[model samples]
Target: MPLSHNPNLLQPRVPILNWIADMGSDISDEIRYRLCATLASSTLPALLGSLNSFCITLLAYARLQNTILLYIALCDLIFGVMRVCATNVSWLRTVAADLVVVSGIGWATMMAATMVVVGFSDDTPMLIIVVASGLGSCAGIIARNYAAPRLALAQVIVIDASFKIPFCIHHPEFIPLILLQGAGFIGVAIWIMRQQRETTVRAIAGQIESRTQSLQDPLTGLLNRRGFAEKAQSMRQTSSTKALLYLDLDGFKQVNDRFGHGVGDEILRQAARRLSICLPNASICRMGGDEFIVLADCHSRQEAAVIGARIIQTISLPTVTSAGQASVGVSIGISLFDPMEVDLERAMVEADEALYRAKRAGRGCALLHDPAMSGASKAMA
Candidate 1:
């Protein structure tokens, strides 16, 4: 029953315990420090699971000198505890990314070393276990850092090299076979990194396209009502002198009823274009149907009136389409913002009231909101 006579035990002439020690010493201090930092940012659950399993396996087998096994377990435990504490510190969080990556490399190196040391007499079993575990670690790195290909690549290189180099040095006769396997793994890693890059880019592009569609109108290519409000809110916070002009297209409903909605859409597009030309600095938005809003910076009430008049004139111009010539006028109501009284909602209501007054005074005119005009219109009604 003695395993001392086993042929497989005699085959491994090279001792791996000394090789592991030499490999650890060969790593530069700077590289070791970086690896330690990376390990600190790695996911706590994954690290804990892998480290605990390896420690338990070593204990079960009663591997050479329980002292070495205990040292390895203690190192992993200290690293995990440091990482958990780092998450709560502001400065530590800044370097957490580097910590996670370095820590992963370090832990992987330790696992590879352990495999070689414990399975020195069983080369075939060691090869299988080491390759499988290396690939699994690579997959985990991909899952965690797929958005960052460079980081994932670095981790993969460290992991695969740790196993491959030591194995090649020990069994030079199997160099060709080992090189071929390493090349295959490198190919797989490259493919995974490329896929991750493409996926990240596509996701970012999709999000941008979705946001653009939400903020823009399909027909006129102007900002929609929601977009205008968002922009105006930010502008209002910064600027003290501002004006709001509410415009309603006159006889637009009749055009839709007579010529069809297709032609009506063309008219709206043309009107938006003309409004943009008239007020180049203004933020213009189509507030659904035939209503539009313009936010502009103005020095005085006179400047607001002038801008409104220009908009009305441009919109009144004949719109030539495939369905012949069509003319639609615009009624504008102006409201000015005062730094002392910053009430956007009240200004909007006043502008709406003035728009009605412009329509009542015969279409295609601009009227500034006045308190006296509102009371007069109410009394007359």
Candidate 2:
């Protein structure tokens, strides 16, 4: 069955055309978004400079009796004005993507039409300069919208055909030059498209990596305290019953002193891995040093205790590092949330108090937060 009709394949059966179309769409969206974003940003000075150049050109061409040049310049001037006005309108900003494509096509068409008319005109110097400027503009557009391969191709084809079609019909002697120019534009567009794709992909990947680094712990590759807090807050808002488990690894300082910080870091990584395995649904965070936090959904204090117990057992297992085998136990304090009272700060304090109680009672145990534990927690502290 044809890929287009299959309802299974995402694209049409023709591989080459499908690939090109997909690439073009991706590039167009990226370039359009970037362009719109740039225009929206504080690049007004640069924009004004570009508009000034166009205005100057318009004034210079107005002296000539060429109606086509005047018309193109006037259209360009109006487009520039609209772009400046668009910055303030919410509706215009929303439709900026479509406007960009339409305006690009319009400008390309006008420039092409101007080139065609100028080639047959009596003003030799003006014709030469206009053709040269048109080619330069094509190059500039290609560079500016490098990510949008289809837009680049369309602009090039329009401009190239404008120059070639009229010259071929009127002069016929410049056929060789026209074919050469056409082939050159095609080659350059393909090359620019490939380069732009690579550049964009790398930029996106770098952004993802940077964002991930900001939120993740360097040692364990687990979410850091800030990341955990943000995620837990969101989860609390959505879920009725949730529990926050505070865990501190026992004898971590001893291991760090005896085996060096390398082994200590490995232990933290292994502990994070274990916690993730034991409580897969929980948001696990390395809350600095030997402390870790887990925010999870629970039906009652009992369910939270069960999860806490699992985490304790998993973390207590001996971790084999390059230096040697190291053992550490975890004391967990679980704070169960009442659906009516969703105070994160109070729950955290309760959990911390419970953790102190667990440490006082024994090293390797899980304790659910209780009001009476507060006095005991103060004494231990």
Q: lDDT of each structure? A: 0.66, 0.68
Worst 10 residues of 2 by lDDT: 1-10
Question: Candidate 2, clashing residue pairs?
Answer: none
- Write down the lDDT that model 2 would get: 0.68
Candidate 1 lDDT, 1-381, residue by residue in tens: 112112121112234312221213433444333333333334565556466536543652463453665666565566655445444445555444444444544565566555545445354654566567667777786665544455566666766776667667778898899779878877887787667556655565566678778989889988997788788777755756878888999999999899999999999999989888888888899999999988888888778877887787789999997799999998888777763466767777877877898889887888887666552222111
Error of model 2, residue 249, in angstroms: 1.5
* Best lDDT among the predictions, by candidate number: 2
Give a tens-digit lDDT track for model 2, residues 71-146.
7777766655554544444555444444445555566676776667666666667667667767776776666655
Give Cα distance to truth, residue 221, candidate 2, Å.
1.2
* Candidate 2 deviant stretches above 4 angstroms: 1-140, 185-208, 229-241, 254-260, 298-302, 323-325, 337-347, 370-381
Q: What is the TM-score of each candidate against the true structure?
A: 0.61, 0.63
